[model samples]
Target: MTAAPPSATDVLIVGAGIAGASLAAALAPWRRVMLIEAEDVPGYHATGRSAAFWHETYGGARVQPLSMASFDTLACPAPEFSERGFLFPRTALTIGHRSEAGAVDGFTAQFQARGVEVVRMGAADVAAKIPGVRAEWSEAAFEAACSDIDVGALHAAYLRAAKRAGAHVATGTPLQSARRMGDGWDVQVGGQAIRAALIVNAAGAWADRVAAACGVAPVGIQPYRRTVIQLRLGVPVPAQLPLVIHIGGEFYFKGESEGRVWLSPHDETAVDPHDAAPEEIDVAVAIDRLQTVVDWPIAAVERKWAGLRSFAPDRIPVFGADRHESGFIWCAGQGGVGIQTAPAIAALLSAQLGATLPGGAIGAVDPMPFAPSRFA
Candidate 1:
């Protein structure tokens, strides 16, 4: 006797990272949702390896509203959803050398025009804020709204809330193929078949690949690798140290617990999607850059890792329905601000899926800039 066909779900979300998980939670109250991940655990890629921080200007003006919209949720999550708070106050300082003083002014003016508060600081103030700062760094811009995010807890909260809302989450289930079945889609996952009325491509670095597998036109999403390293310092790092960055975008470092400092070379090497690993030369370059910024002594290299940050040609996140195929949605190209912008992005995506925007926070924000059809 033949077996019964697999049941259909209202929505099938691919990629169980923070993007997929948060979207599932947003849609669960309105539809039957199913989230699938290729790896054994959710958030095994970019979300897991993120140096999670919420900076309004991190993705530039186009992406700032999304990050700002997500502030309330990240700063104070729902009591039922999360007991552990997700965000903590941490200032951000962007410094420039004497030769690049104009760059610092440009950075301040650009964001200030968008109504973002920024304070100009002289070289002496920058040095006082960051111990042992180089003398050549003469100008700086300070953003007091920046904060550190507890990424792991936030990801878990979204996943848990999604499950509680009746969304089915499947990990270690790789999507083999997908084809249009009537008005819905028939997808093969690992060996089982399933159907869904809508497909959300939230696969992060592998977004373009996932779209192609489903016969949807790719949006030119490119994945870039970023490396980060943790160093054990000989001297104690101030617990109140702000996230120090270079205005020229060379490197950034901040203090962590236990006399350790986290540093990144701000590298953006183009690469294909896979489990990324740090290069030895990149690590060396990070230390060398850190030396120029400060006179701190590095005792030892504690840990190092690399993660893929996907971006569109324009660097703005691609969200909304596909122009050619409305059933295929684009939730890719979040860049480095994916986690920081997840709450607002998910809300906007939910609205696109026929749900009314609660509180209308995202409704007031323009969606034209992030529409996927812009690429088409």
Candidate 2:
């Protein structure tokens, strides 16, 4: 006798990273949800390797509102979600030299116009806040609202909440095939076959591939590699040190525990989706750029890693159901803002899937900018 077919779920979400897990949490209350991950663990990619900071203006003007909408949840998480808390105070300073003062002015004006709390800081102010700040860094834009994020806690909270809400999670179960079956879909994962009324593509760098495998047209989602390193500095890094970023986008660094500093070259090299590793030149470039910004000595390189930040053709996130295939939804191309915007993005996605927005926190913020139809 043939084996019975796998049960059908109301929604089948691919990619068990923050996006997929959070979406599952949001939808499980209303629908039967199943979240499948390609790896043995969720967030084994970008979400796991994030630098973990919540900055309102990091993802440009189009993406700011999503970040703004997520602040409340991060700042005051639900009691059931996390008792350890997810966010802590960590200011951010974007600095530029006298020659690039115009750039700094434009950066400040751009975000300030969008209602983001930002202030212009003189070289003296910048120096006082950041020890050993170079003299050439004469102008800066200070965002006091920036904060460090406990990524592990946040990701775990979402997964736990999702499970509590009755969402089934399957790790190490990569999608093998997907095809239209009546108004729903027949999807094969590993050795099991399941059916779902809808599918959410939150596969990060493999978003396009997942779409194509399902016979859905690709949305031009491309993955790019970014490298980050941790250093043990000769000078003690203050516990309260603000995240320092260069206006020119060359590098950024902030202090971690035990005098260790986390540094990134701010590099965006185009690459295919896979396990990313740091390049020696990228690490060297990060050190060189850090030296130009501060006079602090780097005692030793402690750790280094890289992760893929995928993007749509236009760089803004891709959401909404596909134009051609209504049952297929696009929730990929989040870039670096995925973690900061996860709560809002999931809420918006839930609304699109016929659920009410939780507490109406995303009030009046238009979701058209992130609609996948824009690409069509």
Tell me the deviation in Å of residue 64 in model 2.
0.4
Give me the runs in candidate 1 sitting further than 4 Å from their true place: 1-6
lDDT of each: 0.89, 0.90
lDDT of 2 by residue, 1-376 (tens): 1233347898999999999998998888888898889898899989999997999999889999999999988999878777766889999999898899999999999999988899999989988998888898889999999999989889999999998998888888888889998999999986788889999999999999999999999999999999999999888778678988888889889888867889999999999899999999999999999998889898999999999999999999998899899999999999999999999999999888977876655756788889888975
Clashing pairs in 1: none
Candidate 2 — which residues are off by over 4 angstroms? 1-6
lDDT of model 2 at position 146: 95
Worst 10 residues of 2 by lDDT: 1-10
Instruction: Write model 1 residue lDDT over 198-242, tens digit each, in one string.
Output: 999999999989999999989999999999999998888786689
Question: What is the lDDT, from 0 to 100, of the residue 48 in candidate 2?
Answer: 98
Candidate 1, poorest ten consecutive residues by summed lDDT = 1-10
What lDDT is reached at residue 339 by model 2? Answer: 94
